[model samples]
Target chain A: MARALAISAIVAVFLAAPFAAPSYYVGLLTKMLIYALFAMSLDLMIGYAGLASLGHAAFFGLGGYTMALLLMRAHASAWIAFPAGLVAATLGGAVFALLALRARGSYFLMITLALAQVVWGIAFGWRTLTGGDDGLPGIKRPVFLISFADQTPFYYLVATLVGLSALAMWAVTRSPYGLALRGIRDSETRMRAMGFNVWRHQFAAMAISAFFAGLAGCLFVYNNRFVSPDALHVVTSAEGLIMVIAGGAGTLFGPALGAGVIIFLEDFISSHTQRWLLVLGVIYVATTLFAPRGIVGLWTDFSTRKRKP
Target chain B: MAISTTLRRTLRAGLAAMVCAGLPLAGAGAQTKTPIKIGFIVPTTGGFAPSGEECVTGAKMYLESIHYEVAGRKIELIVEDSQGKPDVGLTKAQKLVERDGAQMIMGIVSSAVALAINDYARDKKVPFIITCDAGANELTMPGPLANPYLVRTSQNGRTPSAAAADFMVKKGWKNIAVLASDYAGGFDTIGGFADALCRLGGKVTQEQYPPLNTTDFGPYATNLDRKADAVAMFLPGGGGLRFIKQFVELGLKDKLPVMDIYAQSVYEPFLPQLGDSAIGIYSTLHYASPIKSPMNDAFVKAYFARVKHQPSDNAPDGWVGAKAFGDAAAAVGGNVENAPKFIEALKAVKFDSPKGPIALDKYGQVIQSMYVRQTEKAGDGYVNSVVATYPNIDQFWPLTFEQYESYKYRYAELKGSLTDCAKVLEKK
Candidate 1:
């Protein structure tokens, strides 16, 4: 009951935030929510499935590029471009899983990383399509979504999309299929022996995770109304992995919290001083030292330790 | 009850800690009246940070001249880092306008960011100026008139390129190779030179668009046509520095005379490090820090005293932007309430800038002189020396406004290839 109440209260705060907060904060929160969605999708692969993929941003960037092309070149509406971006990303994930899942452990990680670099090269070299390093600009929102002119409306739209995506991910993780994923994570051989198609389950999870990451990317491009090579760069992939670890990978809402903390800290700290990178490094070191399992783990440990027998 | 109490205490402590962490270090000093807030955005943390820093220094120098006050009204400048990303640029721009209450906006180090927020600046009805970076001609052309509040005081990408082409053709150099960074601005620079040279009946022996920031230029350099009389190139920022060093190391500089489009390689700060290799290299740009002029001499001296080094191309952009803004403010009697009046004042004003004579054209773009400069030993180090001057140059050079309007693309670089100019022109 407490968990449910906390969840609803958090959502309520985000929903009410646009009306109460300043426009800049509203815009900042909208960006945070999109990043939260990306981080949570990464958590699905790393936490539950025990698959540490470094190329997750490949799907994220592909989603953004796909959406930008559709909107700018094909002149497609938001409804069409948004779903098409998801499908393109899901397919991209499937292809990546086919190549990456063949390997195990460090090999899988390296292969995914290499594959993402290849995508980065394409995005960078293909000037006619991606606008090269300068990036594609002047993306217009759909006529219906033109209400995005106001910060409040745009915030609400992003909140709704992020909320639905998060709820769906949570539901999937708690389902019986989710249990099978946990079993595979613990012992893949045992799961295979128990009549579970472990590979299929892993592949499905990758697809779902990629789909959400791609959705997040679509949201990001539309929100910024521009797309650049930075979206697909290795730094973005590394940042996603950092958010997952910092938020406590196994927990559902932890990654979202981590994303919020990282984004807010970057903005706030960078504003105060030019040496923000050094300060950020110090904060990360402290977090790692104090909360080995992340902030969520720290909270859970504290709560359990205080409970009476 | 004890557990709930502990949780509450922990949460309260966290909340207090966060509030304290988020507080501003020092509050703004009391002002007699609300100062005219100008939000200055620059790429202060990424690849362009050095240039951005120099621009900020130049702007501060301008402020120092007037004691940081304009017509009895204090001027407050808020600086934000764009990180050279369009999204970050837009977000910071919006924050400055929406949250910080900035009446005027200036500075952009990335063309992509400039294009992204052009409409936003228009829609918000804010007086915005592009100072340093962004050479896309569309920014101040037909598109800007729609906004009426937007103007560019920086040199366009094709400024030096066209000047180089005209100079080389006049000197009767027939065969030249074109190389530039592979991007929109790169295309603009190389394409402008190529088209102009070809139109003058000169031959473009080779054309190459090397990827920007490529650490290894071995492949691109070796493949260039070595027999060409010279290579007219545009590689900006750190990439230009690397490319020039590599080209000299490969002995290409000795084989073929090099003419650059005022790249970062030949900029004032890089000249000492570039050493003898950069000497005798012909280049063209709007401003050379060593130009012979009373105003430029004072500006350079002031900049050297403050920065402990020579000013680069970025300083001129900043100095001009601030001067233009100050002149306009003085014209309006420090009252920025009437934005149109302020913009008109800006357009009508003509005066000598640190760069040279500066005045706004009909399209709100700076019409200034483009100098053909050669790198020569000045005192202890090399500096760009003025060789030829194209006076009163506008963004469209040699073409009338109607000719530019009828052109297929806004800029010459959009035509794709040097040979395709006639095709494009015929189609138009």
Candidate 2:
């Protein structure tokens, strides 16, 4: 009952966010939500499936670039462009899975990283198509029944989509397929002995994760109204991983919470000081030392300890 | 069961924290009689951090000169680090305008970042002053990208190189070897040089474009055309440092008369490290520390006292940009809230800056003198000695607006093909 109440309260806050806060904060909140979705999708692979892919931003960038190219160059409608971006991301994820699943453990990480670099190189070097390092700018927000040109309407639109996506992800996590994936994570040999197709399950998880990540990327492009090769860079992938680990892997809510924490902290700290990168580094170090399993893990430990005492 | 409970409690805590954070920040909005806010965005934490710092220092020096007061209003300068990312720059710009209530925005060291913020500044109607090193031509050119809200006080990428081309052709170095970093700025600069040279009856014999921030210049240095009359290069930052070192180490320095296109490669900061290797190398740029002028003398003294070293091209860019803002605000009598009047005042701003006499053209691109300098030893350290001066040079120097616009190709379209520069010259 309390958990239900808490979830409702959080939703209530998001629904009311645009009304209460200034447009700048609303825009920031929108970014936070998009990143939350991105981080949670990565958690499906890292937390649930035990696959630590370092090149996840490739999917994100593919989705964004597809949407941006379609919108800016082809002048496609939002309806067509949005779905096209997701399809591109899904196809990319499927191909990456086919190649990367050949390796497991640390080697899987390395292969994923190499594959993503190939995508990044294309975005960076292809001057005519991708605008090289200059990137494709002046991408306008989509117009539907009503224009999302204003911040408030856009925030509400993003909120509704992200909310629905999160609920779907939560349902997937609670399903029997999720249990089998967790089994594979803990003991692949045991799951295999039980007649489970470990490779097939992991591949499906990869595709699904990529789909959600793609959705996040598309939303992000709309939010920023711009996309660049920076979206595909390794730094973005690393940031996604950090969000998952710092939020507590395997918990759907954990990574989402972690994304919010990181995005907010970055903005808050950078505004106050020029040495924000140094300060952010120190905070990450502290988080690693104090909350190894993440903020969620730390909370669980403290609450359980209190109960025991 | 325990996990769900923990999640609930965590969510509640996060909610409380966010609301608390948002309320205070949003409530602190702008009011009448508040200090005029000027948001300065620069890459304070990336590869361009050093240059960004110098740019900020120059602006701060200018602000200090006027005691930070304009037309009975105190000037509040807010510095935000872009980290050299376009997305980050846009976000910072949005924050500056929407959150901080800045009337004007200034200072971007990276061209990509400047382009990213260009449209945003236009849409927001915030006056953007390009200070530091963002030398993208599209930002100031008359095209789809050109914005009235944006004005570049810094040189366009092609300005210094055009001057260099004119000087090189006059010096009988008709057959030139061109080498620059493989990017938009590099192509723009080299293309300008090649266009001017071709028009002056010179031709480029060889061209090499190394990637930005290239640590190894061994291949490029070894492969440089030894037959050309001179080698013109535009390798900036660390790449320039490395290339010069390797050029000397491989004994290519003596074989070729190298010209530092834009002179940023051999500016004051790199002179001590370059030592004798940079000596006798001719460079073309808008600003050199060794220029003999009353304004330059005072600027050099003030900069050295504050920074403990001679200023580079970036410092002057910052100083000049800030002065334009100050001059415009003073013209409007501190009524910067009147955007149209302020912008008109800004366009008419002309002064003898630390670099030289600077005035904005109708398109808001800077028109100033370009100096052809040589690296000569002064005492123990080195200085860029002005060897030739090209006065009253605009973006389209030596060519009228009609002539420049009549060209079939933009400078960036001539990448890796200096021979095609003849096509541009043909139009003239």
**Candidate achieving the largest lDDT:** 2
Query: For residues B1-428, what per-residue lDDT tens digits would candidate 1 score against the true structure?
Result: 34335534855774465455333212322433557778898888867898888888788788878988897888888888888877778878877776666777898888878867776777677888888877776677675224688878887776677789899988878798777877667776776677567667786777777777788877778887987878888887667777778888888887877888865678777887889888878888888887889999999998888888888778988988988989999998887656889888888778898889999987789999998888988788778888899999988887666765675543433534554546434435
Measured as a fraction from 0 to 1, the native contacts recovered by model 1 come to 0.41
Clashes of 1: 0
lDDT of 2 at B179: 91
Against the reference, the lDDT scores of all candidates come to 0.80, 0.87
Candidate 2 collision pairs? none
Residue B384's C-alpha lDDT in candidate 2?
Answer: 90
- Number of the top TM-score candidate: 2
Cα lDDT, model 1, residue B42: 88
Q: Across residues B282-333, which tens digit of lDDT does each residue of candidate 2 receive?
A: 9988988989999999999999998889998889899999999999999988
In model 1 chain B, the worst 10-residue window by lDDT is: B21-30
* TM-score (C-alpha, index-matched) for candidate 1: 0.92
